[model samples]
Target: MKNTPLNLCTTRLHGGEYGLYVALRERADNVMNAETEPIYGHKPARYLLQEIAAGNKEYSELLLSKETVIGRRETGEILHELALLQTHLWKAGRVLRVRFLEGPEHVHRQIETIAKTWETHANITFDFIAQGQAEVRISFTRSGSWSLVGTDALTERDQNKATMNFDLSDETTSPDAFPATILHEFGHCLGCVHEHQSPAAAIQWNKPLIYSRLFQAYGWDRQKVDTNFFEQAEKALITNSGYDPLSIMHYSFPPEFTVPPTPTPHNTQLSAQDIAFISRCYPFPASSTASTLLKG
Candidate 1:
């Protein structure tokens, strides 16, 4: 998730004040179960229809209904992210032009897959320009301490306009797995902070000492832990009750990050709640316009 398009889990800030950080999670078993609805992202047909009735347009005329999409569940969650991204584009009154740049290796192809998946869900058009130059470059600590992962981003005034470079060379990840991370980081790029880290997150933290223990086990220093873990916790402290621990933004440590209670896996895949939140947060203009037309 880090290289082609960054995911939000893998990288971390090294010894600098405002340097780049990437975060990728510990890779889970990549074998996806077709029967299991991915932890989130499935929209019930009735609900989707109800929302459409509320004023949203069905951009996906050629695509299956929400129910059919879930019943088959043939594709991965990348499609869901694309749909959500499209919703945001509609709301923001903007069009995101996605281009896949060819890199020296297969890395660029992976990035292309991530972008293309989004294009499909959002029902947007894009261009794939394969220039030989790497689409992205990896940034790291001078000490060779860390490589960019999905969870991290370099903090710079110029970072706003700069396209991030993600490092995908690490052997610990699977193809589909990285896409979720990429989606999360892209969420960050779009200005989303961690849901778990919100003020509402504290109510959901459930375990405190466990998190303490986790920090100890990983030898994760206080500063790194603050940025990666506590910052979100602090955010949770102030936010409202929509906090979902099963959120892809959450980490796997049990109650508190202590005794590894019940390994509540951090869903790398988007959840239904996440999809709804994205739809509301970022509805595409056409979708919004259609929604308004329906209301009127």
Candidate 2:
């Protein structure tokens, strides 16, 4: 499809503290797949509601749209693509400066681990020395509740800073992938968008049935589901062309998540495309440009 202007849409997922974005289809001929059962076991619908109410206004707006609700899986992937697109569009060179708030060990260590991976894959240096300032904070409020907050660069009298809040006591038992989630959210803190939503998000969606199940369970309409889950990532792609379904931002919905229980190769970590996207977004530039790059 030829380059087009941004299509106006809204999100349907209920958000409370998590970031949410809607995915819109770039083309009209794409049809929905109907070969899977509608099961609500993949992702909890309540999580989507909580994300709709997240602190970030932009995030909340994107998740509450009707179209967004339709593209259940696409919502998460598109956000990552948008975050990556922002980095490329803004062109931040590669140097990244990060500040970690002195907080709990579980979340702090998880952030640190993810920070290291980001530093390696993003090909940039990150500074975590905040002295006493809390740029990124991770704490728990209650069961089944977590938060990730971030702010772009600022030039006011007060020094610019970004922060994130995570409920360590939540359902994040597997801390290995926890770093990837933190990195994904941190990408937002640095003004990054989802990699899949970048104009390059053209994955064939090998498992449409799985996606359909997610949509049905969430009670999302067709338009919202399509935009939030499939097409939005290809809307404003920053790269030439290509889709990465294995992106860390991509949801873990595979064919196996459907019915029949067949052997399907599934990945649980970030893909090579994700690493490349991160590298391109966070180019290794200078410290001064780090903040500048974070601006847009």
Candidate 3:
């Protein structure tokens, strides 16, 4: 894949390289299914026993990722950019601080209003702060909407600069751009990678169509298209063998974008699988999600 520095799917990492940033997939990949055993991110037995004994099983699940990957996520980078998806995850139950560097109050309000939908299902929270160094500093620049996924948002060279963006000047460019784009970008902030990149998405893309369409629509070159759409994320991000085409994180592909012309509509809201992914990644007390190794 081409090493595109900045474009759509702006998952920033070290060395100015853009990549996917999926948090829980690295640690709590099993949270998607209650019946299946966890594949990764198991907490220590002593901590599990303590949490269970204290009746705080829910919070313990939230601690799974951080506690599990203390030294695990630092492996060698792979050719398909798998390591790019594996890092910068926040520990579960983190209150992600958000601040708008510049935008209308109503836009900010709408952004916050829509963001709560994700919070209801996940353990993560968004604290929209007026001042201070925020994890997500959003700007309404014309440079197109993008975000530094996961904890990478905190890695900006200039702390005062925006780590996320909302280019709302051309809302008519896509359906449900107001809230859908917001949800899509915030999904990145939560360490959720693009659904199209999921291993389950065995989409036979119309290559020529994708290249031309993206070039005409978003001004993205072939390399950027390959980096964002053609590339697939690791199987660790999959909750099940089935791909979720209705996922809010999946881009709205026109009919011609696919080989068989299967079109993905503009999804303004999160899918059931999207909820499950987020919930598993951010275990809440109400969800009662268990760690992979521990039976609590």
Task: Predict model 1's lDDT versus the native.
Answer: 0.39
Residue-wise lDDT of candidate 2 within 187-238, one digit each (tens)? Answer: 5444344444555544455346535654554444566546544655423333
lDDT: which candidate is best?
A: 3
Clashes per candidate, residues 3 or more apart or on different chains: 57, 56, 0
TM-scores, all candidates, are: 0.48, 0.45, 0.70
Candidate 1 lDDT, 98-163, residue by residue in tens: 333223446556555664544333333334443332212333212211222221232222322223
Q: In angstroms, give how far residue 244 of model 3 lies from its true place.
A: 0.2
Models ranked on TM-score: 3, 1, 2
Better of 1 and 3 by lDDT: 3
TM-score of 2: 0.45
Q: Which stretches of candidate 2 lie over 4 Å from their true place?
A: 1-103, 130-162, 190-192, 195-231, 234-238, 254-268, 285-296
Looking at candidate 1, the ten consecutive residues that score lowest on lDDT are 21-30
Please give the distance, in angstroms, between residue 209's alpha carbon in candidate 2 and its true position after superposition.
11
lDDT of each: 0.39, 0.41, 0.64
Ranking by lDDT: 3, 2, 1
The residue-level lDDT of candidate 3 at 38 comes to 36
